[model samples]
Target: MMLTTNEDSQLALECERRIINAWPALSTLVLGDWVLRFANGYSGRANSATPLAYGAELDDAMLDMLEELYRADGLPPTIRLTPLVAEATRAAVLARGYRVKDASFGMIAPLAGLPVSEEAELQIEARPELEWIAGVAARQSGVKTHAGNLAAIVEKVRLPAAFASWLVEGEPVAFGMAVAERGMAEIGLICVDPAHRGKGLGRRIVAGLMGWAGAMDCHSAYLQVEQSNAIAISLYRSLGYRQLYAYETRILD
Candidate 1:
């Protein structure tokens, strides 16, 4: 049996930290209060700012600092908030015209209940194959991951990770990644080809990642899935994943 030494929130936060740490940020300014991250206009998850150690003051000046940093990177200023954020900080961002984007649920589960499909065909790689990278990038709409950025992002993950691709007719149709750190495993980047949906491929890919994590002696697994993704939420719920918290990225347009 796997022991969960940390509380749900703590485990979720740790998983989130490790996942963000895997991103290949072009520039990052980590002050004592918050972290401002940028990746040359890559995905917002890499470029947007995030608040940390919640007790710090979040005033207009800090907002100015964020704007300056993002403007320098040639991107709009955005702040990503989580349940860990202070209520006043969230209100401050909302009071401004910051619209929420990609509000998602942070879900976690023990590896024991994770289900793997025998019919699903998934190929696992330490480094993302060229086809796998291209397949994933194609599925992304806004803030897409170009080939170079995709390569950099995958290569930046120093922890034990597996890039899994769902193959159909010897071509990748879906792609995702699993990274294990500090006894916790994080599964993310789960994307499916629009041409091929409702095939249970997502479940299989997640199962493959969870199995891999379990084999690595990881006690627990976690992932951030969009709240609006009903199919994904249902699938994860069926596989015994529970919501730990929800986070949203607010963009200054």
Candidate 2:
């Protein structure tokens, strides 16, 4: 569904809140009314600080506190940004090296026209099993062995969250989640078993989540996907999802 500028802003704000709500951080700081999140080592979304909701320039104290906090956690302070973030703030980040990460698009699809597949029927659980968590962890770099962290994340997921998985003969082969809030659903963290990549398992997983969202009275489904993921982007487009907004993450070493 096409959104007006006001509607787009509202949707983005809603999704932002839903994501933060569904996956809460271990701690948070309010620097000049900006959000600074810490979630140990789970993922960038939980650990990286962002210049959101705060309009003024960042002060030295804020940066120093961030450095101290993340350093204590054994991580270099990192910042994540969306298109609305100030370019000046980005230019100011000190880093030994930098790289583009999660160069992503916020995409959404109307629930009215989503297609369903028999394969989607394979997803029968609203909550993922431990095997499902491990399947997703094994597919992600640096996260496979951190079962404790992954389990914590799964535990933190709020209600109305849909955890979907594909199992073959009692073993999980794919995993994904749909977080719904305020009439919108965000389908995220969809990963398939390396051995099952050539099949339509990814599509089936996403279709199942979207179908679930529609059934729950959600008006639209959305997600954040790295722009470089051409295959996944193609799948979502084929499913009638369109880009709502784009965000980029600049990693500092």
Candidate 3:
């Protein structure tokens, strides 16, 4: 079992809020402390319901309402279960036959001691441009069809944000972004060209983002990665990021 301190839980909640803000959904409905998000099936993080605040109990009535709302929106009723969720809430979903779908870990690292990268080929942009967006779509298969939605999501980020790209021969080969909220920064949408996988371009992009966040006066950085992605987990661990919490999506099929 994973152990977490009160400070860890609070930080996780803070990161979660930043993530939701940084990646805005097309439509959202707030029921008690739960936030039901819909993004026309673009991405799971933008489409699933998230329990942003703790201590709110989920009863069958609330579950039924959530199901009706999603059904009306042409989306499957999906809930993201995080560490802040109550054990009884998990049981409630299980009783309703919701099965586990995807699991991921929320990771954090302090920006104080991270080494700034010396890569001279990195380019930082105030906003994501066409070239950077196209590079990300070319690398991430899932984002190809949803590129427009992805743009809309990123455009809605109200906080300080930075888009980083690693260039090779004046062409972008890696892409990532950082959004700062309060004293923390959330990194997301990291992708690298297939030909540049083992060449440390991913690390450079991440380091560039962290360096940018540190310059923005952010004390900590956070990111979410699938639990099964060993390569990414290993890379983040090497950069001093530790697992702050784990979350899984439960889908009623």
Supply the TM-score for candidate 2: 0.86
By lDDT rank, best first, the candidates go 3, 1, 2
Clashes of each: 0, 0, 0
User: TM-scores of all models?
Assistant: 0.88, 0.86, 0.95
Best-fitting candidate, scored by lDDT: 3
Candidate 1 regions exceeding 4 Å error are: 1-6, 54-56, 113-120
Backbone clash pairs for candidate 3 read none
After superposition on all C-alphas, the RMSD of every candidate to the true structure, in Å, is 3.8, 3.2, 1.5
Candidate 3 per-residue lDDT, tens place, 1-253, comes to: 2436879878888988778888888888888888889888777888888888765567889999999988898888999988767789878888899888889999999999666666789999888898887778777766445678778777777889998999999989999999998899998888988988899888888988999999888999999999999999999999889999988988898
* lDDT (CA) per prediction: 0.77, 0.73, 0.85
Q: What stretches of model 2 exceed 4 Å from their correct place?
A: 1-4, 54-57, 94-102, 113-121
lDDT of 2 by residue, 131-248 (tens): 7677777888874457678777767766688888887777778878887777888888888888889788898888898988887788899888888989999999998898887766
Worst 10 residues of 1 by lDDT: 1-10
The true-versus-predicted C-alpha distance at residue 97 of model 2, in Å, is: 7.4
Candidate 1 lDDT over residue span 149-220, tens digit each: 866667777778889998899888888888888788888889889888888888888888898888888888
Off by over 4 Å in 3: 113-118
**Best candidate (score: TM-score):** 3
* Local lDDT at 153 for model 1: 68
